[model samples]
Target: MTLRYHAHKPLRHHPGMPETRLAALLSDVIRRQRQLHELNQRRLAELAGVSQATVARIERGDRSPSLPALERLLAAMDLQLTIGVEELDAHLDARLTEQAARPLAEVLDGLGLDRIVDRLGDLPYLLTGSTAALLQGAPLPTDAVEIAVRWRDSARLTEWLNAAYAQRWNARWGEYGGVHIEPEEPGEHRWLTRHGELRAQMCDELPAGIKVRHGDRSYRVVPLVQVEATDPRAADLLRRHRQRQQAAEAPAG
Candidate 1:
């Protein structure tokens, strides 16, 4: 005798998440469905009447599918999207707010730059690039903490950072419009330690008075004006950072 099995209940999600995060979660759902059904992009596209490229893009996180497109795609797999309002966990919500409202100095100290600055001494340094943009109330994507010092301090700063991080320092000349000082860590045990190099500028003109005063300690940060006047790429970074903050501030659907 032939038997038919009932399908599992669909997964449900609560609302109030950022749109980008929600899109990412939905993308994962579609990808998992495709994998379980052993279907490729072309097949999914055929079933959903969407282009193969559209299916590929959605699955790869390159593009967010429209609601109609997503509904059709999910319907092909006998699934549907549900949106509901649910109360956020009080403790988690409070923690996120505290982190977002934390002062730049506290953030730097948490990232261990406070210790680095203390060891490196007051060499007329200012944190630069995206990190600076972030400190200036911009939500920027900063891969590493970039810093700048006077042209004369490059060699000394290199030595200081190498000793401080317990890694070999190598200066890649003529990179990022100046010498890029990267720390060469030993072995493959590198984790949680911001895996990008600190930018060291050997420029004559470095901004002043951009320090974050935290009680007795003062941490240097590059001025947004300086970042705007510097390289075109750096200026573009500031623009993108501002755009991200604007998008984040947008109302949730």
Candidate 2:
């Protein structure tokens, strides 16, 4: 089945979007609307002043309707075709949550991480642990944020981070005199503001969905699916973590 995100209302299609992508998004919305209303192709065609074949083609991904045609089609389903900027991040977060409960493999497939990485410029950095989990609105056991780095590239990565997060770096190394960075202003560092308590690690294999960007931050998050699949201990850890969070958030009895 095609990946689908259910919307409480129809998605707004903005102008200047490529025709093919727009058509695909619109078709999904229309298909969902028709299913919600329990209307047959013939009924929708009659309501939209279109032929059944046309509606069939649109729903089947074989054709894209002109603007006027789309308007009429949406009107039939009590939806309006409008132009507006969509909150893409919020939409993506919703889609992530929608698939969170599925099998790890299924969640990975739906995320299309391979496809998403193609568009990102920076590479070779990983955002792991509870930080990634929280970004996607999933419950986590802890909030300690960690960025994984290749042991061979630790020095280079540290230099890059110091440059990127200038003025925040402590300019002093941890007692180990290694890759550890002592935040100058531990409680109010820029990295801390975006990713709580940033620390670096040298590792061989990073988790899935680990890239180099999370929202406005530079470190990318590993998808929870990957975390669960690659780390045998993750499931039990996450369960306990979530329970702790729920307990903390629960109202006084």
Candidate 3:
């Protein structure tokens, strides 16, 4: 998924720190580390001497832990918290610019999209998210392809992926090797393979899509309007691109 950034605003007490982003980053780190260590909230809380509710709240990003609490939690997992500073958004902006300059077809080819589609054969799928936007000529940078498939079709798709691409279902952070496709919550399942990462949005039924041809292959893609409505990243990119176009055509105002 694309990372969203707000306008540069430093925390008053923390100087360069973006409070919201840092809280999210910290929560993600704590949750992933706990999962990697094979400890649930209760287990981690026991080791860290914190209440299970506290662990849950921190992992949910609803609360920021004090330094003592944070260190204790990290220590239980054999980790140490470290702070570093760099130019915010510099790397991500540069990467996005580089991707934006490349043709969408080239990006798809690099990600082995054609091989994937050919292998899927008759399985129904509609490209979604930024991938769909790119397919619909939105000029968005798509790192990975996302597809929406019916819930009933997920098992067959998983079987095909395993047989064809040796795909492994990503169960948790640094965890894999599930033969079945099970989503913990609605609308999210990811599989990893040598080809690349394939993210599937499980749905009761496939959304309506428009057919578009890319490099001699016709693909069903979620319409630009649908993508804009559903995907925040794609929506933001399209919004900014339209703003730029409007500014350029403003007759030198």
Candidate 4:
């Protein structure tokens, strides 16, 4: 059986989660718990007083069980569902807010931007995203050094990363060493290294950047307008920062 919810209403009234994702999470949790308990579908169904077909459907994400059904399934495996509230992206948001208040030069120093720039050595990169925003005089908080490099040059960049003992960041597995990095997939590719986190946006051709001077050094960074237009996260943070500044400056009512 398939389960559906109103498109306008998010699952459990959470701001970011959708019904489909919640269903998938439930499916994964149920399947993994059953496996951990060494119970097959038929055995689990017997313990939970549910049909084997119901177990199969739930595990396959073909059905969404009601609260009682879900609780029974979990109880059969000696597991229980617990819910807790968390601030989404709390760590990142806090970091951004903190960095937004500091000097851009200090932020760059903390990121070890010079080390990455020097390591990249003639690889032809332009600062992008929050890094670019900061270079363009917008105090955006960024945890990683973001750069755009040509697709053709990815191989060379990968070599540098590998030599520096960097590991590719995987969503499910965290970081692992010695994986080939390429622009085969679209969007940002990230790596964790001793120096810091590095994020690269591979492009067919390098984006236009303007020279900016900071702390007696010049760097090429994507223009603020382009960054605001293209990078939504950076743009949103910048927008919020500006709003806070405006509120602070406003006279009391």
lDDT of 2 by residue, 1-253 (tens): 2222334533655556676767667766776588568786778999999997777767765557877787788878777654556654334433434445455434333333333333223647575555456555564333234455566665565465555442232213111112334332232222322212344445676555544444444446777776655444445556555665587799998
User: What are the models' TM-scores?
Assistant: 0.43, 0.36, 0.61, 0.61
Better of 1 and 4 by TM-score: 4
Badly placed stretches (over 4 Å) of model 1 are: 1-110, 165-197, 214-217, 231-233, 244-253
Whole-model Cα lDDT of every candidate shown, in order: 0.57, 0.53, 0.68, 0.72
After superposing candidate 2 on the true structure, give the runs of residues whose Cα lies further than 4 Å from its correct spot: 1-7, 14-16, 86-90, 93-253
Q: Rank the candidates by lDDT, best first.
A: 4, 3, 1, 2
For model 4, residues 152-213, the per-residue Cα lDDT tens digits are 88888877887778877533321233354554643339876767779987789987889999
Assess candidate 1 and give its TM-score to the true structure.
0.43
Question: After aligning candidate 3 to the native by TM-score, how far in Å is the CA of 86 from where it should be?
Answer: 9.9
Kindly provide the TM-score of model 3 when superposed on the true structure, using C-alpha atoms: 0.61
Worst 10 residues of 4 by lDDT: 4-13
Candidate RMSDs in Å, in order, are: 13.5, 18.7, 7.8, 10.0
Predicted model with the maximum lDDT: 4
